[model samples]
Target: MKTITLIRHAKSSWEYDVSDIDRPLSTRGENDANLLSKKFIEYSFAPDAIFSSPANRALTTCNIFIDNLNVSKKLLSVDEKLYDFGGHQVAKFINNLSDQYNKVMIFGHNHAFTAIANSCGSTYIDNVPTCGLVMIEFEVDYWADVKKGITKMTIFPRDLKD
Candidate 1:
């Protein structure tokens, strides 16, 4: 069995006059990401590999999760292909993931993340918001054979609010 978890980047700061790829996380994003990281352990979300978009906000979010999980930096990679917002490139990249890593996590943007969750997982998600996490389970032996699987869980920042 293989599992893949998708995490949408945390809220970004528009305060800086920077390119979309260079935008940093907002204060809310930082705190929200930290909160989500604790939830990850609570949910027992320990993956074999963690991939993130090269974009700043996404990378920052991934880093926070990595830190909280105590995941080695060696297991994390920044893939430009994951920067895709259209869902096609991201989908293609996931479909071609190496078989060596059976359980994986990807930090990226939407509508790609939302689209991926809907298409690759049996559950339907209308949107994947900032700091959102969705876990999917696949019965395939290899990622290349991936198709629709089970939507095991989903956690959003709003769901944590008092």
Candidate 2:
């Protein structure tokens, strides 16, 4: 079995004059990221690898989660393709992952995240809010074996708060 945890980048700060890709996370975003990370730890769901988008907001969210979750594994890597905003592209990227990682975490943008969740037959709420985490489980032996409509779990940040 394989598990994929899709995390939407935290809220970005428009106070900066930089481009969208360079926008950093807001204070609220940082706090929420920390909270989400703690929730992941509380649930004992730690990924073996963390794939993150190169965007500043996404990177910041990944870092905050790493620190807050206290995950000792330093297997974080940046993927430029993840910067794209399409659910199909996201699924393609995930399907290409190596078999070494059974549990993977991805920090990226939305619309794509929501699309992927929907494609996997998970009923995600509108806009997977900033710092939101969606955990989807698949009963596949390899990443390439993943298919649509095979989701076993769908967990959101709001659900974690309960």
Candidate 3:
């Protein structure tokens, strides 16, 4: 089965003067990412590849998790399509993903992540909070054929201790 793991960028700090795309994550976001990394290790949910939005918030969160994951940096890539907040664009991006990547992780913005999770996963998640994680497993062999797959798991910062 092909698997895709989705992650919404961690909470961003509005206190910064930078543009939304350049805004960095808040302190709480950093801590949450670290906590979620531990959960990934516990669940042994290692992705073969990692993709992230070019935005600073998304990239920072990806880096934090990768540091804890001990995965190769070569597997990480930045995609412009992932920068979209709307789900449709991101959905197309996922649909066109290379079949070579069976199990991959994506770090992106909220509305897109939340919408994609609800549309693709069996679970009906109202919102995929900051630093939220959702894993979908498709019965198809190619990424192009992936559709309403099973929602293997959904995790968030609130599920872990502060």
Candidate 4:
């Protein structure tokens, strides 16, 4: 089985004068990312590799979670395609992942994230909130075998608040 953890980039700081791609996460986003990382550990879900959007907000979110977990930084890769908001682009990126990575985490933007989750038969409301995570398990043997209607689980940040 292959596990795909889709994490929407945490809340970004709108006060920044920089472009959207360079906007950093807000203070709340930093805290939420850390909190969610701990929750993932409590649930015993750890990714073998991480694919993050090149955007600063997403990268910051990824760094927060990885730092909170004390995970090695060597396993993370910044992918440009993750910056795209189209689910098909994200799907193609996932399909091309090296076979060695069975369980992976992706830190990216919303719309596409939620769209991909829905495409996998998982019901999610609107956008995936900042710091929200949806864990989808596919029974397929390889990443390339992943497809729509294969989702086995979906967990949101709000659901973990309780």
Candidate 5:
């Protein structure tokens, strides 16, 4: 089985006069990332590989999960393709993923993430909000052959808010 988890970057701060890629996560975003990471660990879902957009907001959210899960930094990689927002590049990236890693996690932007979840997952997701996660499991053994698959789980920051 090929399992792919897509996570949208946490809410970013626009206070700084910087490029979109350089904008950092807001305080609420940090809290949400930490909360969601811990909540994900409770489900015992671990990815064999982690990929993230180089954007500061996205990378920072990915790092929070890595730190909370105690996963080795070696398993994490920065892929520029994930920086895409239109979903084309993200879709292409997922389709061409290495087959060696059955379970993969990607952190990026959306509507790309939302589009991927809707296109590749069995369940219909209206939107993949900031720090939201969606896991889909494809029956196909090869990543290239992955089509529509079961939506295993979804985690959103709002769902955990007390």
Candidate 6:
């Protein structure tokens, strides 16, 4: 079996006159990242590999989760391909993932994340909000063969807000 977890980058700040890829997370984004990461730790779900978009916002959110979840920094890698907003590149990246890793986590942008989740997961999600997480489990043994799978879990910052 193979499992893929997708996380959308936290809300980014537009106040900075920087490129989209260089934009940092907003204050609310940091808080949400912290809140969600802490709550996610309770689930005790660990990924064999973690990949993130090279974009600043996505990488920052990934770092927050890694620190809070106590996941090894070694498991993390930045991939320029994950910066894709469209689902095609993201899907191709996932499909080409090494079969050695059964469970993997990815941090990236949306439209791509949401699109991929809706296409592959049994559950239909209108959107995957900032810092949102969706985990899909496939029956296939190989990553290349993963098509439709069960939506095992979803964690969103809004749901955790008190």
Best by TM-score: 6
lDDT of 4: 0.83
lDDT values, one for every candidate: 0.93, 0.82, 0.91, 0.83, 0.93, 0.95
lDDT by residue (42-154, candidate 3, tens digit) is: 78776888999999999999999888988888999999999988888889988899888889999998899989998999999999999999999999988889888999998
List candidate 4 segments past 4 Å from native. 149-155, 160-162
Clashes of each: 0, 0, 0, 0, 0, 0
Whose lDDT is greatest here? 6
Assess candidate 2 and give its TM-score to the true structure: 0.90
User: What TM-score fits each model?
Assistant: 0.98, 0.90, 0.97, 0.91, 0.98, 0.99
Candidate 2 or 6, higher TM-score?
A: 6
How far in Å is the alpha carbon of 22 misplaced in model 4?
0.1
* Residue lDDT tens for model 4, 1-162: 888888899889998799989999889788778878877776666679998999999999999888877778998999999997877889899888888888899999878898888876556457678888888877877888888545555556676675
Off by over 4 Å in 3: none
Candidate 2 lowest-lDDT run of ten: 148-157
TM-score of 1: 0.98
Report the candidate with higher lDDT, 4 versus 5. 5
Q: Model 5 residue 94 lDDT?
A: 85
- For every candidate in turn, the CA RMSD to the true structure comes to 0.8, 2.0, 0.9, 1.8, 0.7, 0.6
Q: Write the per-residue lDDT of candidate 5 for residues 56-109, one digit (tens) a residue.
A: 999999999999988989999999999998899998998899989999989999
lDDT of 5 at 113: 90
Stretches of model 1 off by over 4 angstroms after superposition? none
Q: Show the colliding residue pairs in model 4.
A: none
Better of 1 and 2 by TM-score: 1
